[model samples]
Target: MVPSPVEMFRDLPKKVCPECGEYIEEQAESYMMECDRCLANKEE
Candidate 1:
């Protein structure tokens, strides 16, 4: 079975924070999944 390039890249580890728009650390263990700025500016 041959794996596609996109699939291979998708399987790689991510290092971007979803919440604070900060860069995730290589050794970090957890993600917030929501950007702080986004949340703060969210429509109420």
Candidate 2:
């Protein structure tokens, strides 16, 4: 992981899922603030 992305992810106030309160991680620099499971559900 790059220092910047990690820093950015760490700084996000949008860490836990609003709907489910599950913990999540950053997938990309521009990824929506969603967990893997929630993101997949969103795509469906």
Candidate 3:
């Protein structure tokens, strides 16, 4: 039997930002490697 979306999501590893040690939110379709705050700071 296939697992529900929530169950599948719960089983996935937590995504953390390597730059600032912050917990990154998961996106269904994203290529972001770092948290927004850090990324913004990096661009300055």
Candidate 4:
């Protein structure tokens, strides 16, 4: 049987911030390697 859309999403790997080790939520079509907080701190 084929997997449902929800199941496919659940199987996707979780995106984590390399600098802060926090889970990164996908906000757009582009991929993000770090969380917003870490990115801001890095810019300082």
Best by lDDT: 3
Candidate 4 residues 1-44, lDDT tens each?
A: 99999999989998988887999888769677889999898899
Q: Pick the candidate with the highest TM-score.
A: 3
**Using alpha carbons, what is the TM-score of model 3?**
0.70
Deviating ranges (above 4 Å) for candidate 1: 16-44
Which wins on lDDT, candidate 1 or candidate 4?
4
Model 4 alpha-carbon miss at residue 4, Å: 6.5
Name the runs in model 4 displaced over 4 angstroms.
Answer: 1-6
| Cα lDDT of model 1 by residue, 1-44, tens digit | 88999899679876565656676445446455645556566755
Cα lDDT of model 2 by residue, 1-44, tens digit: 55788788678685687767887765666555666788788889
The clash numbers for all candidates, in the given order, read 3, 0, 0, 0
Give lDDT per model, in order: 0.63, 0.72, 0.91, 0.89
TM-score of each: 0.31, 0.45, 0.70, 0.67
Name the runs in model 2 displaced over 4 angstroms: 1-14, 27-31
* Candidate 3 per-residue lDDT over residues 4-43, each given as its tens digit: 9999978988888999999898787988889999999999
Lowest summed lDDT across 10 adjacent residues in model 4 is found at 25-34
| Lowest-sum lDDT 10-residue window in model 1 | 24-33
